[model samples]
Target: MTTSPPLIISVSGIRGIVGASFTDDTVRRFAHAFATELPMNARILLARDTRPSGENFAAVAIKALAEAGCHVFDLGVCATPAAKLMVLELQAHAALILTASHNPADWNGMKLVRADGIFLDAAAGRRVESAYHRSKRRTGDGRVESVARDDVESRLLRRILDVVDVDAIRAAHLRVAVDPCNGTGALFLPRLFEALAVSAHFIHDTPDGQFAHEPEPIAENLVDLSRAVTEAGCQVGFATDPDADRVALVGETGQPLGEDLTLALAVQVVTERRKGPVVTTLSTSQVVTDAATANGCPVILTPVGEVHVVDAMVAEGAVIGGEGNGGVILTDVDPGRDAAVGIALILESLARNGRPLTELAAALPQYSIEKRKVSCSEQDLQRALDGLVQRYPEALRHPVQDGVKLYMEGTFQCPWIHLRPSNTEPVVRIIAECEQRQDAVELCAVAEGLLRGE
Candidate 1:
């Protein structure tokens, strides 16, 4: 007997470990299911990251999609955001991106983007999921063509340049270091740097999927990037995940800035130029709220997911929006989160203010946010959440969307904890933030104790 590897299917799309639960058969099934949702002879964009499995998966996806009666235009080995942009630029019916974004090297899966160039919302995702399970596959006559789509990359870079003060960045003569973790960012960053005339030092610049370190780009995984910034005497350092859809930062002092700050800084920049609503997730730090508040921009809180943020952004006419996990969404450039956009915004922030990243970060409102995960069965997790809700009856509960977020004393700047299940893994996430680090740590401990029935 063999156990099946877990496959994560949600509004985020289907993802699983390659050669495990995610096989050629899995791709064909989802491809066929997605094809059924579109019209006959629909135009579809296909792209992938630099994952070693991407090539084979793309081949399978192209053939599967083509056979299912959708025209497949393959943009081989491109970033995830670029694929989303191409979906809109070409006015395609939809897109299939063959990359398990931010997942491990052995992981490869597909992200299905709707005609609007955004991930399908929960309703749309459910429709696809229902089709996938029915074992009904659609077959139609279509063609597969390999496309360069250099215009996608050019347009992405061009939009970044257009949104920022290009002359200011050039005059600053900024020196920066980057670690793409040997993924698709390696292919885009050089062009961006050349266009900006900024000096750059790159590590793991290869487009191969061999990650030099753990690929999440969080502080713990960015030791090399931190050291590179300090040793190279660069003004800042950046690290992007495998697909380059997200990015994290290191300041001038060789210290890794938390992922939340990436959105905070981006918010600061965008809200300064345009005043509108800012959308983000509940798990995001209050620092982002503070940044937007300082700029007199209203903030909208959504459930914890990129699609949630993007949906709220579009509905609210948001000037900027993203999740706290280093994903920044600027509608002017693209509806999806783009690291290239985040990079340019932060650089422009530094250049416009004529200050170092460390100083700029230090000037932000202070808060301590801690994120932790614990292995939990669904039954136990639900019981723990119920227990916590009862245990803290006085805590003001925000509307339960994806999870439960309880604000201590129903205050914004006070301590708070959010308990939610992981979308991609088999665990429950405990995110707590407070003015003091120890308070946040204690909050997480409390959540963990309840989760364990302690």
Candidate 2:
């Protein structure tokens, strides 16, 4: 039998195509590695999204953790953020979430979290990689167990209620529409709204692996959500990816707020309540920075990944952080990217301000961001970065920590252009932010041209 391609491991987590790079053996190996790295007799939480293959992989992971002599808490069919919440709620030493967020349905992988409920940073991830390569062995009579279904949702709800004003949300008498995109969000969001006493209209809320539309919450893929917001005549609409860790929103006007606004709005809410530093990835829109500045808060930019963002948040003592892709992290609630937390925060902001979602979003700085990916061999990336630096010497400011980000001074109405190579995929991502859509388009075109050595 042919061996599957090596799993793609990183600071964020490990992911690969199910049958190809991510196989049963690979899952076991990684799980064992994680088990070995965790403290002795430590309790570990295992959760997965609604992927068809997740149960099988989760089973393998449970066994591996048990064999490595750790108590396993099986939280079947939970959102990635829910898993993070469980880790903190149970005070488990670690968590393993089986999901491939925004990737195709056929893909599934594991996201490992530490005791603090944050994705492992590069240093921690490297330790796991080292342990995997060393093939460390531990012997114990540990066993795997399942969490009671009756306890799951209630426990999650309690954590959520602690941070959000459930009473205020219910008093607002909000009618909201939720689209889970056939992911794990379907499992918790409905119950969350019910507990808040808010009327919720659900679409694709079934926790099935089958996806009704593309799992990404990008504007182009959110046509159904936009229409649902209008058809349901709800005050607002919310959508999440397969894992439900990321979220996107639609206004009462049935207009998509775009994913970037999700984080910006959430940040605004958090800063308004308690001003502090915020964190986001480099590829995020300038609107987030503008919002932070307006709130008299500074924004720290990290590389593009949840791990990087979380690390920065911890380091900076940020009160709020997230990526522009609709993933919001509230340190007041949890340090992980939590869609549920984000939704509650947004609703609370609406309740406090007594404004429609559209008007609230419109109040933020407006900037158009365009993202494009180009196929390029790994060998060509260095040359491309070199070329970018040489070509835009005067206009370029390189923060080589992540992928190369180019700051074009006064070139466009917006601040900077970031061109970063994908760590897991064989493509370089070009992200340009500007006040004008045409300017963003032109920036992407120019960056793509330069990266391709045109």
Which prediction has the highest lDDT against the true structure? Answer: 1
Per-residue alpha-carbon lDDT of model 2 for 265-287, expressed as tens digits? 88887787677899998888888
How high is the CA lDDT of each candidate model?
A: 0.89, 0.83
Question: What TM-score goes with each of the models?
Answer: 0.98, 0.94
| TM-score (C-alpha) between model 2 and the true structure | 0.94
Q: What local lDDT score does residue 444 receive in model 1, on the 0 to 100 scale?
A: 94
- At residue 220, what lDDT does model 2 achieve? 81
Q: Pick the candidate with the highest TM-score.
A: 1
RMSD of candidates 1 onward, in order:
1.4, 2.5
Candidate 2 local accuracy as lDDT? 0.83
lDDT of 1 at 182: 95
Candidate 1 residue lDDT tens string, 52-147? 988888888899889989998889999989889888888999999988888878788889999998998889888888888885678789998776
Candidate 1 stretches greater than 4 Å from native: 1-5
